[model samples]
Target: MLGALAQAVERLPPARRWLVGLSGGLDSVVLLHGLAQLGGRVGSPGLRAVHVHHGLHARADAWAQHCQVLCDALEVPLDVVRVDARPHRGQSPEAAARHARYQALADQMAPGDALLTAHHRRDQAETLLLQLLRGAGPAGLSAMPRWQPHGSGWHGRPLLDMDRPMLEAHARENGLVWVEDDSNGDLGLDRNLLRHEVMPRLRQRWPSLDTTLARAAGLQAEAQELLAERAREDLQTLRGEAAGTLSIPAIRALRRPRQRNALREWWREKGLPAPNQNRLEALLQQIRDVGPDSGLLVTWPGAEVRGYRDSLHAMAPLPLLDPASVWSWDGIRDLALPELGITLSAQEMLRLHGLEPALLEPPLTVRLRRGGETCRLRGQTRILKKLFQEAGIPPWERDRIPLIHAGDRLAVVWGLWCCDLPAGAGRR
Candidate 1:
């Protein structure tokens, strides 16, 4: 195990920092010990251990103290991160703890640091089976990747290829002690039930069940990579004017499976979860049924997809904007519209659209556009609604855009349009 870990760690980029998530479990304990044995190696990455205190178990403090003692003996710095693991409505306690735990670990990591975990072949097998039971696609079935970007840095599981028995053997040979979480045998948790009950029975019938499952996971991961590569190719061909959005026509032209794959990749790149089956169906239905003048948005937990005119947009769930809310702003100063999820500032305008300082009108009030607003563009006065429609601006965005009034005269539309101000600042 030590030899394998050494080779694995050395294969990583040298002269970077690394931190191990020390849970004080047998797996993590063995991981830390092996890394300690490789003391000051070329790719050691200034080793450190961090213990996350989920505050769920009664023995949580004891586990943290044990981690500290081990780190002290190993002569490595330790950080104990305490987090509230209270489950949200309809969420499992186990999942909530896990979410809080990773966020805490992410907070401790710097840009170039890698957070190491002790997930092994058995864990990979278990993860694959769980995902399979949930009827997951290739992406989910490709479980427990060897490495992935975690928070600001990266996450690596160097022991993923090693067996659980190897880690146990190394721990016993080194006389290492670890805290056994009493909840390990709790059948209420699906993973625990599989580990304690289901796995043993399967292993009895097929002695190499874990190994076979792990190999299947590897194959799925390779297949997933190919799918991602194809998605990338399709995206390049279908790229839109904006970042992280797709040309709707190009997407519609592809076969259904390609459409789904491209959309999943697009959402993933935008840092949003892939839409579930129902949401994806809803999204496809919208695209197919949308009229020439219609705009539609389909949303699911943590993500949304919207189509307007020629483009399809995927992003994190947008904030609920109340069109009734209005704000007074001096065009010279920055205006932060928290409820609308936008900051109307001089720099943003200047950097993005070259808003001249000469247009810095004092006492310029900002408000959401109500119906019946009018502005003269070019020569004739045009209704704001008609103008937005003519410009092909999506209906959902119209009310959220800030309208700038230069002392009761409608002067500039924050993002969409600008009238010629007295200072000639809005001409561009």
Candidate 2:
């Protein structure tokens, strides 16, 4: 087991540090032990361990203590992160815990660090079965990759090719003890049901089920790569005037299957959640109904797609903002606009062109456009709406753009047009 693990560690890309995800469970404990043995020989890259305290189980604190002790014995630095793992509406408990755990671990990684998990062949097979039951497409069926770039660093599974029995044998030979999460026996959870009941029955008939399913997942991964490559090629031709927007007519030119493939790939590239088949089909139907300059919005959890003026724009669901809301700015301190997810700084404004020195004075009012506002740009007094149209700013964004006011006349529009000031006017 040590020899196989050493070879696997050698295959990992060079990194400034390696973070082992120590859950205090059998699999993780064995993985950390093996890595500790290889530390002196493998040019040990700042070996350390992190354990996420999900606080979901009764023994969650105990688990953290166990991980600390184990890391201490191995002379490894350990970080225990506490996270809120409570499930949100429509989200399963398992999913919430997993999300929280990974998020906590990811926070501990730096640019050149890699987080290793002890996911073996059985885990891969179980993931494939779950994806299959969910009727997922090629990308989902591919299961987890051995390693992938995540956050500022990378995430890897070094024990991906090994079986659970192999890890158990190594643990026994080395006198290793581990904490067993009681939740694993709960049949209510889908993964537990599959592992404790369904898999054993299936394995009775097919002893090599894990290897077979893992192979199938590998093939699906290959298919996903090809699809992603094609999508990248198609996107270059279908790009719209705006960044991340797709040309509607170009998409319409493709056949239905290819359109679906390209759309999924586009979502992947944007790091947005993939739309289910029904949602994708509905979006396509709505696209066909859209006329030039007319628009429609399709929404699902975590993301939304909007068709506007011959383009499809995908993004996180837009936050609601009241156009009548107002904020006073001192023009000295940074102003926080939580609703807009941005901060406005007077210093940043001073670095830009077309701003009157008086615009940066005290008593400035900041608000969204309430319509009928006009500004002078290039010696022409134009309505804000017309200016937005000329600038190709979408209607949904017009109301969200921050308008800085000096008593009723517009002084500046954040990130867009600034009112033209006469030479030497309001200069300090």
Candidate 3:
């Protein structure tokens, strides 16, 4: 088992720091102990462990303490991250907790760091089964990869190919102790139900059940790679004027399966959740009949896909920014616009014409468009709507753009345009 672990660790790309996701469970305890034994072989900056305190179970605090004790014994650094694991609308408790745990881990990671988790063959098999039950596609059936780039760094499962019994045997040999999560016995949970009841019965019929399912997942991963490659090639030609947007007509030119594949890949690239079959089909249907002037929007869960002009845009649901809302900003300090999910940097104002040091004596006002606003740009008096149309900014995005006003005169439009401001406009 130690040899297998060493080989797996060596196979991963070298990282400056390695953070172990120690859950105080048998699997993670074994992983931490094994890696500690290898010493200096894990990462250049040495090994550290992180325990996510999900606060879901009653014994959550106890679990964190157990992890700290083990880390102290191993003489490795440990960090316990507390997170809100409460489920949001349409999200399962298990999924919410998992998301929160990973998000907390991601927040601490730096570039060139790698997070190691003790996900073994059985876990991979269970994941495959769960995805299968959800009627997922190749990407979902791929389960977890052994190594993949994650937030600011990378995520690795070094002991992924190892089985549960092997880890249990190692724990016994080393006299290692781990805390048992009482939640594991809750058959109400899908994974727990599979682990305790379904798996045992299935193993009776096929002794190599875990290995076989893991192998199937590996094959699906390979197929997903090919599909993703095809999608990338398709997207190269289907790209819209914007970087991440897709051309509507170009997408319609592809066959149905290829279109679905391309759309899924596009969503993946944008870090948005892949829409389910029904949603994807609905989006595709909209794309087929969508006119250049159509305001077609297809939404699911955390994301929305909209067709505007000749492009298809996928983004997180736009925030509700009341047009009446206004902000005051000093020219020298960076201004954060939480409602718009952006920061207006002090340096960005340098691009605005005629806004010299003398003009900034009075503070600037920022507001969203309420429509019927007009501004003179390059000596031409144009309506804000016409300027937005000329700029190719979609109607959905126009309302979100921060319109900077020098007194009552529109001076800038965030990244879009720097309007012509009259001399001493704000000081008027």
> Candidate 1, clashing residue pairs?
none
Task: Give the per-residue lDDT digits (tens) of candidate 1, residues 1-428.
Answer: 77899888766554367899999999999999899898765447688999999988899999999999999999989999999999998778988899898999999988889999999999998999999998899999999888888878889989988989899999989999999999998999899989999999999999999889989999999999999999989999888776656888887899999999988888888888887788898888778778645767888777777777778877777787666776776555677888778888867667754665336565567778778999877777889999888887777778778887767778778776666556455435
TM-score of 2: 0.96
Q: Rank the candidates by TM-score, best first.
A: 2, 3, 1
Off by over 4 Å in 3: 40-45, 330-333, 345-347, 357-364, 378-380, 416-428
Per-residue lDDT of 1-428 in model 3, one digit per residue for the tens?
A: 99899999999888988899999999999998999998866444578899999888889999999999999999999999999999999999988999999999898898899999999999999999999999999999999999999878999999999999999999999999999888889999999999999999999999999999999999999999999999999999899988789999999899999999998888888899988889888888989987988898999998998878889889998877789999988776788998888887665565554344235535588899999988887888889999899888889889988988877678787776767766655333
List residue ranges in candidate 1 displaced over 4 A: 13-15, 41-43, 330-333, 346-363, 420-428
Give the per-residue Cα lDDT of candidate 2 at 68.
89
Pitting candidate 1 against candidate 2, the one with the higher TM-score is 2
Model 1 worst lDDT window (10 residues): 419-428
Error of 3 at 66 (Å): 1.2
Error of 1 at 87 (Å): 3.6
For candidate 2, lDDT tens digit of each residue in 1-428? 99899888888888889899999999999999998998778786888999998888889999999998888888989999899999999888888888898888889989999999999999999999999999998999999998999767999899999999999999999999899999889999899999999999999999999999999999999999998888888888889888989999999898888888888888988889987888999999987777857777889988999877898999999998888899987776788998988888855676764444344444688989888989998899999999999888888888888998776668788888778655554355
